[model samples]
Structure formats: structure tokens, C-alpha cells
Target: MTPLVSVYIPTRNRSALLRRAIDSVLAQTYPEIEVLICDEASTDDTAEVVADYARRHPGKFTYLRNETPQGACRARNRCIEQAIGTYVTGLDDDDLFHPQRIECLVDIYRRHSPSFACSRFKYFQDPAQIERLREHRYSETELARADKLTLPALLYANLAGNQVLTELSRMRELGGFDESMPSWQDYDMWIRLADRYGTAVCTRQLLSFVDDDRSRARIRNSSRRAEGSERFIAKHARLMNADQKRNHRNIQYVMNRQRPSLGEIARNISLGGYKSTLKVLLHKFFGVAIG
Candidate 1:
């Protein structure tokens, strides 16, 4: 039997983009899917758009509009709770899934039996002009195979998108996305899920992330990123090893401009040796970029 995949889209005020997202799901090669649209109290015609889809598609579409504007995490959790599918994934309102995305992901799950699976995806600026796609290319070339990700790697960066297809049961057991986080909620969820059951990545570009040109600003917004990273680190600090802690602190320093404590530096040096620790310190104080 085919598995049912639930694609939940948590959106607010992006009705035009939301239609594109919904259409992508509807156009998936995989037939067994339920598209859940969690509207965060959109004042626009989001309701009408969703209602029209419901009328046309019948059972394929599910809609829930919040009375007030809850954040993305809460909206996602609300939709996930109501989803009736064997596996589930999320799609940002501004993104699009390739035609074979669900079909490929579901096949990977069945064949590899991974707890959750993610694939490399491209990031493009504008979909309207297909020629402009070549102008800006953002693709994942790392993890070209199904390798188990380490906490250290994930601690430093979010290697995958929020569109990872995970088993509904596993997600619930791990406790869904951290609702308190204003950002990096997807990264936090990936760490927790990977830490528990291990993570595998498919070396295929099955999704397209429409970079709204907001990522740079979001990255530069040190406070928001730092707060979310701090929360994630605090929650999983006990499980992290010395190297992981050092990397986590390094990220904190880089993003938040918060200097690492003397004790932290000493611990990192003792564990990682002088050369690496010195390099990190130089990057921290001298503004040298750490790759």
C-alpha cells in the first residue's frame, strides 16, 4: 500500500505565494497526500483561496485559520496535531517542491527505513523568470550520500531544510518543534530528531527554496539567532561532547558577538588542543571568518 504524506503549510499574509505552494503539493507525482494549510489569522483573502481549493479538491485539502496570529512554530504544531498521515513534511509559503519530491522521499523511507529523510534543495530568487535561475544558484553539495549526521555538525549549522519528511510517530515522540523559538525552530527540531534516531540525507535536489532575500537580514539579526541557538544548546548541552560544546560556543560568539568565557576557552583548549583553540580565538577576536 502507498503511504499518505501530509504537507502542512503555515502561512500568514502571503496568499499569492501560498497558492503556488499548494499547487506544488497538488502537482506532486505521489498521489497519496493531504495538504494542510494553517493560516495564522491572515487578514487577507487567504481564507477564500483555501476555501476555493477545498471546494475544488474536496478531501485533498484541509484548512485551519487561527483566531489570532500565532507564530510559525505554533501554527505548524497545530497542523501537525490534526494531520492524518503516515509521514509528514512542511512547505514554506514561498517555496516549491519538485514534481518528484514526495515520490522520491517516500521511496527513500521505504527502502532505507530511516526515521526521517532530507534531500538537497536549490535556492532561487525568482521563479517567474526561468532564465534568472542561472543567475543565483544555492545548492547543497555536501553529504552527497546517506551519511548519519553528528551533533557537532548539526550544532554548528542547520544542514537541511524544514521540509524533511519524518514519521509522524517519531516526531510526536521527540516532541514537535520548539514553540518558544522565534527562529531556528527547524534547526532545533533537526538536532533533536537526529540526536534521537539518527538522520540520513538523500543526495538529490527534490525541493526548491525561494529565497525571499530575507535570509541575510535574518542572519545579521544576531539577537534572534543567538537566543534560539542558546535555547537549543542549553536543552542539549548535557548530551554534547567537548568538541560539540566548543563549536556551539564558537557559533554563539560569531553570531551574537558574545565572547566565550575564560573557562570555556580553557576547556576547549584542553579537549581540542592549542592550535585549534588559538584558531578559534583569532576568529572570535580578530573577526576572521571560520569556515
Candidate 2:
């Protein structure tokens, strides 16, 4: 029989953390679920870890190890393609889901029949930090009155909440996750889905045990990643509405705001030499916008 949900996990060289993520999914109260582990040519023992689980669980776990390093977006696409359930949920290798996550989400989907659903998530540096992660609970009244959140807002809110279980038809219609982007690919897809289908039905506090290590944040802060996100927003700008277009533009501005301008680059290179200083003065006087 087809499973009720397919939990998709895309991992790199994070075998240890991947085990934890898988364990959480296995522990879910919802039994009719399958786990699809897509490994992006991990250098670590990720293959061994996933293989062990697949060996033990057999039909419940499907493992795919890509030969090339196609990045997380492609890995996710592979997972979606392999999913055999009515619903699909993304489980990041480094994140953990609460035991009730699948149960709660599936219940909402069955009752409300929303195209997609998202829940509140709590972040943590450590298990003890879980307390610090909790803030205000999401209010249904507020969710009803709120302007449908754009993908950018959803990313900023960190509330796209990892355990997405959208209908398979809707997901395929949205073209799955964009494989072109390495980071914020989920953001792009979420924006498209929200604009087209609607705001994902909101559930309260279904995700937990998010690790906020420095390296993860640094990866998010990288210039290459930021540029990629900006380019994605720009590429999709024309497809968005007025508010969504504005949101995408704002994301671009925010991503590029701290970069050095042409004048600043020339000044740094010349070390305030007479010619460079004169050039800067000329540009300032002419009111040139040197980006």
C-alpha cells in the first residue's frame, strides 16, 4: 500500500546529524510513512549511516546516493521524484522533527484539504537552548487577517517550518524545488506556491531541535549564496505581483547592500593616491552612483 506521507531528507557530509533527523522521523506517531534519504555524494560516512537504517527498516526507508555533488536543491529534487506517498515533507539533515509532527500535519491536511501546510518551529543551539527558541505562539486570528506572506517574508520569519507536506499534484504543478539555486531554493518554491495556491495552513510548534552552529550561519552569510539568491529573485521578478515584486527587489537590495562600491574599490586599491583621490572627488562632485 502507498504510504500516507513521504519524508524527504537531503544531506551532505553530515552523517551524524542525518542519523538524528532520520531517527526523529522514524519515531513519529504516524506509522504509514516512508523515509527517502537523498545523499549528495557526502564525503563522510553518510552512506553507511543511511544504509544501516535502510537495512534495518527495509521497505520503510529508501536511500539514494548521488555520484556527483549537485548541491541541496538537486538533492531535494531527487527526493521529490522518488517520493511515493500522497504528501511530501522535507527534513533537513541537521534538523529534527517532533514526534507528533507528521501526525499533526497529516491531520490538518486531511481535515482542511489545503494545497500545502507549514507549522511553527523552535530553534536551538543545544537541547537546553530549546527554551530560548520558544517565543510567541502563532495565532489563528492573526494568520487569517495577515497578508499572504511572500517567500522572502517566510524565509525571514524562519516559519516556512521544515515539515512541509503538500499534495503531490500541487507540488508537481509548482515544478518541485528549483535545482538552479543551492541556498534559498525552498524560499523561491514557497513564494510560487503561496502566490498560486494560497498561504499554507498553519500548525503550531511541530518542529524542534534545530542546531544553529556557526558554520551553518556562515554558509548562509557567504557572498556567493547571497548573490545566487539575489539572481533568483531578479529572474523571477516579472512573474510576481506588485507586492511580491517589491519583496523580491527588497531581498536583492538587502543581499547586496554591504558590498563595496566602485568608488570604494578604487579608493582602497589606490590607498588615497593623488590621482585616485582626484577621481573620487570628481565622481562625488558629479553625483555618480557607483555601485
Candidate 1 off by > 4 Å? 128-145, 150-152, 215-222, 257-291
**How would you encode candidate 1's per-residue C-alpha lDDT over 1-291 as one tens digit per residue?**
988998889988889989888887887778999988899999999999999999999898889989899888888888898899999999988787776677777776776776577777666655765234323433334223355455555655666766688888777887788888867788878878777886555545434455554544443355777788788778888777777667666666656544576677666653433344665687657766543
The stretch of ten residues in a row with the least summed lDDT in candidate 1 is 134-143
Candidate 2 residue spans exceeding 4 A from truth:
1-3, 131-159, 206-209, 216-218, 239-250, 257-291
In model 2, the clashing pairs are none
Error of 2 at 282 (Å): 30
**Model 2, 60-147: lDDT tens per residue?**
8888889988877777788788888888888888887767667667766666666567666765667545533433233434323212
